[model samples]
Target: MRTLAERAGVSSATISLALRGHPRISAATRRRILRLAEQLGYRPDPSIAKLMLHLRTRRPPGFQSLLAALTTVPEAEEQPYLRELRRSAQARAEALGYGLTVLRVAADAARRPDLERMLRARGVDGILLLPMAAPREFRPLLDWRKFSVVSATNAVLAPQFHRVVPHQFSNALLLCEELTRRGYRRLGLVMNSRHDLTVGHGPSAAVVWQNMLGGTERVMPLIFDPAGAGDLREWFERERPDAIIAEGADNAQDIARQLGLRVPGPVGFVTTNRSGPSVFAGIEERPDEIGAAAIRLLTSLIQHGEKGIPKVPTVTMVAGAWVEGRSVRAPSRAAPRKAATA
Candidate 1:
């Protein structure tokens, strides 16, 4: 401690304070101390850390520990949900007295071995994964057995980690009900075949079940892929849906334009995954709340020393809220309702 303090030109007491993430120490000093600690190959002893943690239990918790959030840079066609998830996780972790380190996926993949060693050395015992499209893209980057892991969404397919994702079934039901209440009976669902699987086919189930009810029309979900939506026009003609619920606003708009239809006019359109604000009425799946919930679950796992995949993995799903826009007609006389809860 004294040596690291001397190297950083700070007192031993300051070094200890910085190591524990004491608020009294300036942020600049804490960063420099941690950087120096890393550069000098200073690995904290787990036994001492546990002992200190035990000692501090009676008092208000100080800096509890450090966690790392693995995230990716968004692509041109991608939504900002993953980034927002990581940001929310970071904020919640800090508020709970746990420091968070943000690590990029593409940038860190090449030197993963060194990264692994560094994380273990720095006592980063928890990982909050925020992969954008597919978690498979991140599987090869690290050995997961060493740390307590939590994901921001169900996007993790390969070896499913404990995750907090939006409750797609609940969101779909909410969307279907809201659309129906707005005087739309013939409703059709459109989703890429690949996306539907990733989300566990929640929307498809909702569409099928809703159409079976008293006041709705039967419209089978059109599941397409990147190869092409070759039969989209054919499907639309056959279904003649009054309103369409789609995965992407842009994709739906493209198809709608080809069909010579006006959105929110003779035909209404809604999206299941609406990112940010737009001229579309749909469900805004709250990734921020998902991230925060993941952090909360992860901290519990870490405190209990539960590392690696559990015997029976559990999922925590957050409910999404409805966002209104000009893409759909106004609701009938009955008042607007709050977001769904499940």
Candidate 2:
């Protein structure tokens, strides 16, 4: 500060105000001071900058405020996975000296009265969106310019808010390689198209790409409607794959039984998420970690007063951990018997 002020022929106080772009400093003086600082390579330390910001925004005790986890999904408490995300987010918010609340806003306008008003009334300035099973556009009547917001799902297509999610692409590729290492070939991927699109088709695309890289006969992915479970068995029978990768636990179990196959005995099975205790080897999405990261990002945005859709939206991916379960095994190496002489 002293050196720059001397070079710019100004007092240290004038240099500080000019560099900070305080309104009291004339524009010409601000430009001059900035140019001098640049020439001197006088960059402010980030720690000092953050301390100065904290001093400026310091609130008296008891003024510490609330943030919100906004959701459109009903009966969120009944869903243990959603509960885990909320719990993790709340814990992180508390750790950052802010209280967090979960607010369920109905999708229907009749039931969802002015969400913006509700938020402003409670003085909530930051919002964390929970993951949804299906993609939905956020057509809020509220003024989005007033608050910092982020989503934990790709389901929010409108406004393209920043997101934090599982690394579906790499995770799927890793799973396929792991399955191959276990001596399982003829891998089949089955998932609902809607759900696949909701996650940006990374998992499904990875499966196909991996199969293509193997330089063998291409196996088609079996995409089925999740609401229609009856066809699952039919697809399994038709594909006759040595192993299957799916997202639903019940559907996988049912298809395995219909084929008269025991998991890891005759055929192998893998699930995409560890939503519950199961005998299937799968990936753990770790919603808790994702939730914590969302809070961390949201807090930074709130502190910076960044609101509305970001010009450069970012998607932060958390890699899922693989869980080894009793659902896969090494492929049979028995030689094919010679065809009977005809």
Candidate 3:
């Protein structure tokens, strides 16, 4: 400050105000001081800058008082994994000296009020939006410009905002390779048709891509629709995959039981998205970690006052951790013999 002021023939106070673009400094003097500072390569120390910012804002650091989660509450049987996300997010927010409020809006509701107004009324300047099974209405349902919004789901495809989620594609690819390396020849993917949208189709795509990279063995994915189980057994028999990968371990086990197949005896089971520690071998999506990370990003956004959807939205992907469980087994010498037709 003194060096720049001396170079520009001004007091250090004038140099400071001019560099900060304070209107009190005359335009010409401000420009001259700014030019001198640039020539001197002056950069404010971050600690000093933060201290000055606190003084100017007349508020303590962490000015963001509260944050809210705007969610389209799903039907009772919907994604139960989201429950863990909210719990973990709330815990993380409190740890960071911020408050987290979950505001629910039913997906089937007829009247969708001004969500932003309600949020503002609650004094929330930041948001963590957990989109419903179908986020088609995410745009029309909320005012994007009023808050620093971050999504915890990759399913929020339209009118994009910054998001944090698991590395679904890589997780799937890793699962396939792991199974194959263990001697499973034909690998199968069974999951809800709607779930394809949830992880952004990363698992589905990765499975297909891995299949393409393999030898002759291949199994077409069975996209399960709850309305109709739709030949899950027939698909399993036809594919005769040595291993099965489903959304969760429970789904895989149930499907195997229904098919009268011996799990890990002939056919191994693994889950692509494990909710938590389990007896299933596969990737742990770690919704808790993802939730914590989302809060961290949201706090940074709020601190910077980055309200509104970013022009180039960012996605922070947390890699899924491989959890060894009893569901999978050693490499298969050959796929189980094909089942007989009716």
Candidate 4:
């Protein structure tokens, strides 16, 4: 430490802070100290450092042991995505031999006391944040260097932390290509307005559909509120799309029938997620693979004692399968063009 300080022409404290990658250290000084440490072959003993801090503060045993803190906010009802994420995380943690602790914060817990207290206590070594309707600002309350954290969902708007999300872009492109190969052209997409393009699969699917169709195909964006079934039916009737891609297969079929459209014989449909039933051609989304990947990433950070922005923030995406259901039909062969009359 003293050598690094002298070589970098900075205080020993500055050297220490820089080695820990403290945000308070000036960027120039941090860079110099890091370069010096590398040249001098200096490496801090993480275990000893933790022990010394505990000894000075009289903290509890296992203060440095790894703990994955899973957190979610209270909602009216548990969302299907969140439920699947929770199940996958717990199962992965058990397989990896790590302790998992879940913390539920109230809707307004961002400004509350309990959350701050838990952070100060160092209750966990890292956090896996689940998706929520409302954003939470808990990063400022904790020492990021002491813990590693990553958000399981793309709900983190700022991209302030590491994330593992579905590869919606590529997945959507694949789906579009498959549909084209299966002899369907006029494609339509139905999605909620509030769905995040980066986090959710809907937007990517839309972009891919547009690009794949170019100027030759008709693409419709049907935004419907579940509360207004009448508006939904009206849009379907007016558009009269040949094939529809929706989040809900059953609901889409019902709406299609209400519009006097026949499924599998005339109008066809596909689903983005095969969550409830495999009643239509759909993408699997592979939520379980996403869950397992998040665990692997978090554990890697813990095992290596890595903290703050990973050297390489991994964006792991799993592909969804194309399951054929009774909702898609082979396009009718166009009538042979009659030879021009002589």
TM-score of each model, paired residue for residue:
0.75, 0.77, 0.77, 0.66
User: Over the stretch 119-181, how does candidate 1's per-residue lDDT look in tens digits?
Assistant: 999989799877555424456677888888998755566457888888898999898888977
Model 1 residue 29 lDDT score: 75
Name the regions of candidate 3 deviating beyond 4 angstroms: 1-42, 46-63, 74-80, 108-111, 330-342
By summed lDDT, the worst window of 10 consecutive residues in model 1 runs over 131-140
In candidate 1, residue 35 scores what lDDT?
90
Model 4, 58-158: lDDT tens digits are 73322233455444555456666567877788777766555676666554434444554576475565677676555445554445565677777665554
lDDT of each: 0.79, 0.76, 0.76, 0.63
Candidate 4 local lDDT, residue 84: 81
Candidate 4 residues lying further than 4 Å off, grouped into runs, are 1-76, 79-81, 107-109, 119-122, 134-146, 196-216, 224-230, 250-265, 308-314, 330-342
Off by over 4 Å in 1: 1-62, 72-78, 106-112, 135-141, 334-342
TM-score of 4: 0.66
Q: For residues 1-342, write the lDDT of model 3, one tens digit per residue.
A: 888877888788887777665535655776677677778889988899889877866753353368988676644744656888888999888876688887777664334457656777888878897746554546666666878889998666666899998888888877877787677778888888777877888889888877777452767988877667568878877888878888886787788788887655667788987776676788877888889999989977765557788999999988876777777875456643222111
| Predicted model with the maximum lDDT | 1
* Number of backbone-clashing residue pairs for each candidate, in the order shown: 0, 0, 3, 0
RMSD of each: 10.1, 8.1, 7.9, 10.0
